[model samples]
Target: MTIAKGDKIPAGKLRTLTADGPKDITTDEIFAGKTVVLFGLPGAFTPTCSAKHLPGFIEKFDALKAKGVDTIACVSVNDAFVMGAWGKSQDAGDKVLMLADGNADFAKSLGLDADFSAYGMGTRSKRFSLVAKDGVVTEVNVEAQGAFEVSTADHVLGQL
Candidate 1:
């Protein structure tokens, strides 16, 4: 089932690129004892994801942090290298955590995985954003297919 408000985030290993190399970050390591804003997209560097979805969060990072959000993360079903490159290209800097769910484990756990074979993208996560406090989701906004309304940073900030 799609994860909802009040549900505990499921366990999974996501990859993050570091200077040393790709590192595995567990779900508990991310959400434990903190308020996190996590947004997932279909893929990195896609038109909408690069043009709007990711930029919205990057632009609103400070506002979201001021609202007591500890971490802002962007997850996609791509390898760490691609995620890292995308982050750098977008000038994400230290503002947003770029997570690589390369195997779609996290997306599947949340029931957010969708097949994009028609687009030649294979399986990917739906566009969505959520607020998790101390490991439990407090709010979730899942966008409709091909829509960008609910999961925008402005909408997520309004929920804060």
Candidate 2:
């Protein structure tokens, strides 16, 4: 089922590129004790993702933090290296944690996986954002197919 408010985030492993190298992060490790705002996108370096989705989060990082958000993360089906490079290019730095769902396991678990085979991009995560507190979802903003309205950082901040 698609994740929703009151749902516990599915258990799975996600990857993040650290200074040393790629590191594993359990879903619990990310949301267990924090109010996390996580936004998942179709891919790294894609038009909408690069120009708006990711940048919006980076721009609103401080505002989200001011509202008691512990972490703002950007998750995508791309591998860690790509995620890292994109984060760097976008100046995400420590403001937005770039999590890689390389194999789409976590995305599938959330029932948020999409088929983009027509575009030659196999399975990818649908664009969405959710707020999780202590591993339980308090809010979810899933965009309609091919839409970017609801999942933007400004909209999410309004929800908060």
Top candidate (lDDT): 1
- Give the TM-scores of the predictions, in the order they appear: 0.99, 0.98
> How well does candidate 1 match the true structure in TM-score terms?
0.99
User: Which window of 10 residues has the lowest lDDT sum in candidate 2?
Assistant: 137-146
* Model 2 CA lDDT for position 76: 98
Tens digits of per-residue lDDT, candidate 2, 1-160, equal: 8988899999989999998999999999999999999999999999999999999999998899999999999999999999999999999999999999999999999999999889999999999999999999998998998899999999999988
Q: Give each model's whole-structure lDDT.
A: 0.96, 0.95
Give the Å error, residue 147, model 2: 0.8
Q: Which ranges of candidate 2 are over 4 A from the true structure?
A: none
Predicted candidate 1 versus true structure: per-residue lDDT over 1-160, tens digit per residue: 9999999999889999999999999999999999999999999999999999999999999999999999999999999999999999999999999999998989999989999999999999999999999999999999899999999999999999
Candidate 1: residue 124 lDDT (0-100): 95
lDDT score for residue 25 of model 1: 96
